[model samples]
Target: MRLGSLIETKVGLNTRELKKMSNVTYYLKKFADNDLLLGYRPNSSKVSCNDEFVTAGDIVINSTTNEATIVSPLNEGKILTQSSIKIIIRDTQQLDLWYLCYLFNGSQFIKKQIYSLVEGTVLRRITQSNIQDLDIPVISLEEQKRIGESYRIFMVRKRLRIHREEEEQKAIFNFLEKKITYVKKGNKDEY
Candidate 1:
């Protein structure tokens, strides 16, 4: 989908009862380039520019709906606290911070929206305000915590599985090499 047309939902919770709380914050890429982020970490005070920094740790959001790794060093320490950052602080009690971080890092949900706003001549960047405007799924704080923990567990398991597979592959390669060497020596005896 084209980046502009992908954003069809609102930026916060859809509570039908009484009220839905929402918060917003801003971040900018200054010191880092574009390849150094895994995603935005709240309260991270690392910076590379000449300004008062508001580390990713301070910027809270429901989710990060942008292209690229949301937490790249390229973009890290670059986000400032000035007009360039545009911190959107929403008063959200339904959703907690961890859940919002998980949602923002999701791949399928953020692809088109991030692409639409990430525009620049040389850097291809998105403003902090634009990110706040991106739609996010809001839920109860308990649910948010559950989802966030699930995401963390899932990542840990995946890494462990990958490591095991790599070790198995290495063992297979070693066995094959030993067998090949033995066969070569046997054939040489006939000479």
Candidate 2:
């Protein structure tokens, strides 16, 4: 089956519309880059009204990487950026959303297809038609759920590992800074 048959992809706000609004006060989290948006910053600014917002289970495809990941609750209420596209599974019963995400994100065959479909020279964009034409393998609902669950679990662990690595980097930097301060002051109280 074609992937497009099971999914609907929505392009995000144009660059101009997005530019007019301030990031300080956004109703949506502004889904763009996973690396920067994984953990949104806290602010006291009032949220502006918005009708279009992304929810958990929605898929976000990274324009650069051509990879997709299911949105976690942490990223809900995000307005899609121009560079990003939000994918919604048409019917949940037949095709597992997470399983499709795994295939789009991890499967070498699909990745190659996506790579070939890329059109733009600078941006390397994927059109809706291209997305629709990709092939999908049909499997039983139960088996699909199993694979989807495994993929979801794998993604969670990968995120946690990334978070741990970032924390470790911060800790090491702080330790070195403290050591430098202690050495410079000739104070061993904390050291």
Candidate 3:
């Protein structure tokens, strides 16, 4: 089924609108490294409605990455910039949001389409219609739930592993620094 038939999408504020200042909502912009929104900003206009805000379970896509990411809990009230588009699922019963995100971030079929669209563009940006019109594989609700749950677990584990690796590298560098200091100041200079 085409994703457009299953979900409604909201484009974020344009660059001139979303700015860093008095906080209305944190801004989700491009170059966001992880699954979380990174910065804060406010819209010059009045607080119109809830539709402008994004909550957890919403998916955000970037033209640069051409990938979809699930909004983290930390960014429940965040707004978005033009660099990102928020995808809202119309029916939770019919589809699993997390599973859909997994497919967008990793599925070859979706990636192929996205890559094709962004292939020769200078900004590599894709229109909302492109994402809306993507063809997605259909599966039973039960299957989707299972896949979504596993995908969530995989993300958690991947985060932990990366954190562990970073800590290990820091420790190694710290120890090396200590050894270098000792060699420089101690009995013999080790070159």
| Cα lDDT listed for each candidate | 0.43, 0.67, 0.69
lDDT of 2: 0.67
- Against the true structure, candidate 2 reaches a TM-score of 0.75
Off by over 4 Å in 2: 17-51, 186-191
Give the number of the best model, judged by TM-score: 3
Model 2 residue 79 CA deviation (Å) reads 1.7
Candidate 1 lDDT tens digits, 50-81: 33333343332222223222233334343232
Worst 10 residues of 1 by lDDT: 1-10
- Measured against the true structure, the TM-scores of the candidates, in listed sequence, are 0.48, 0.75, 0.82
Cα error, candidate 3, residue 73 (Å): 2.2
RMSD to true structure for each model, in Å: 13.2, 6.5, 5.9
Residue 164, model 1, lDDT = 90
- Global CA lDDT of candidate 3, please? 0.69
Regarding lDDT, does 1 or 2 come out ahead? 2
TM-score of 3: 0.82
Clashes of 3: 0
* Residue pairs with clashing backbones, model 3: none
